[model samples]
Target chain A: MEGPKIYGELFGLPITQTLVNTWIIMAMILVVCAILTKNMQKRPGKAQVIAETIVTVMDGLVGQTMGKDKMKFAPWMLALIMFLAFANTSGIYGLRSPTADLNCTVGLALMTFFMTQFYGLKSKGLGGFLKGFLEPMPFLLPINIIGEFANPVSLSFRLFGNMLGGGIIMALLYSALAGLYFFPVLIPVPFHFYFDIFSGLLQSFIFTMLSMVFISGAMD
Target chain B: MEGLDFIKACSAIGAGIAMIAGVGPGIGQGFAAGKGAEAVGRQPEAQSDIVRTMLLGAAVAETTGIYGLIVALILLFANPFY
Candidate 1:
């Protein structure tokens, strides 16, 4: 349908609705996390319980997917999943999802790409990392190199396309029912359920899980 | 203007054609789901793990379909033919 609204120019750059929504989401998450984690407690209260559950679940996920030794990545992976879940579901609140923007998804995917490479190098050393490219056969080096570059492109497009597709479908559905009484209100709930809630959460999980797999795969 | 109209018509057809890529993932996912179901039937205790692994693999398989969708969307909303 329509592109994200350009609110105004900041310096030479245009400030868009996507950026505003992203900032709002960031602040909301920050506030919620701060409130949940307030004060030290040996016996956890309700808020602390929520915080502890989130941390424990994330740690468990990282441990299961990436192994116990890679528990160091749990916090980063938790932050990623939380941001993605919120961004993908922002459509529910009538805010355009920041993840629908190509720039946002690409930036995230690039972070994964860099982490994968950096960790690979760190664990394997420069020689071993290069040797990885030559594995199975030296002739497959170019293919391996291309495969490495393709990872970020595929990861970014996978996320961007899914969110964008869901947004487009929801937009089309809303407009088609706009003139009908009660139809617009009733018909879109299931669509919203699938696209905004179910698909949003699933995609976020997939993205986080893939990142963990990639990063850990590189390290080991 | 006449040539522009022809280009637009061709782009519309191209968008539809791009979506043909969905067929592969549809078939692949169905096959994967069947196997996943079989695995669950064999070991009910590991159903959660089986489903999780199935979903992850299915998502990866769905990437080609997503690429097709992206091309179609670009052609429809952000057409360069104009």
Candidate 2:
């Protein structure tokens, strides 16, 4: 498929604008994380407040969904949600979202797949893990294995497709706006509101929640 | 031997093929929605928060679907090969 073209080559590697923007975003996340973590406060500072709110919300979410036993996974889930939320919302700027790249999405999905497997193996020993597949029907072992194999493929593609769609629409919308700025404000604003802001955060949450669901299901 | 016509038809077909990616989010979001409904039904008091979380998750699920649409649209209107 003819998608965004590489602008140039750096050391034989085709570096697209998306790749550069991802580095920029990565740098920003690292800086922010460092700053936020370094500044610890008991009374409460504004930055700490913001960070605490995010952690509190996500922690509550993990506790509610996965039960108290899985609270350890909360921090990982929080990091995933924040990283993805930022990655998806990066489209608001002129930069290409990293989520648009299959590499990024697939990598994230692979991590989730591994985490699910890891947690499953931890909660249930190797024999118990194998027994999970044989549930409901011992005859369906092969099919169940195939279904487990397909999880990451499906999960990765789901996020990739959605982010790519929003980015493309936003691109087209901006192009449309360039030619016709006088287009009804309501029409464009709501579209941006829903597609970029809402969809970005929503997708990240879904990714985390579904990852949790799969892991919990496996362990159970 | 109308090669150009074949390419155009192929792209049109390709556009449709791209949209097929929409199935991923459709099923994913539907699951989120059903879970949200179930959560709300069980605990009506937490309806607002449940709905909020559900929508957030559904929004993430919606992204890939949007990507497929973008590909389809590009194929239709901004075909690079053209």
Interface DockQ per candidate: 0.86, 0.45
Candidate 1 CAPRI level: high
Best by DockQ: 1
Per-residue C-alpha lDDT of model 2 across residues A103-193, encoded as one tens digit per residue = 8889999998998898899889999998989988999999999999888987788788777777767777777777864765666777778
Top candidate (TM-score): 1
Shares of reference contacts reproduced by the candidates, in order, are 0.82, 0.65
- TM-score of decoy 2: 0.79
Model 2 gets an lDDT of 0.81
Fnat measured on candidate 2: 0.65
Residue-level error in angstroms, candidate 1, position A166: 0.2
- Mind giving the per-residue lDDT tens digits that candidate 1 earns over A35-144? 99899599988999999999998999999999999899998999999999999998899999899999999999999999999999999999999999998899999999
Off by over 4 Å in 2: A1-14, A34-38, A181-187, B13-44, B53-82
Clash count list over all predictions: 0, 12
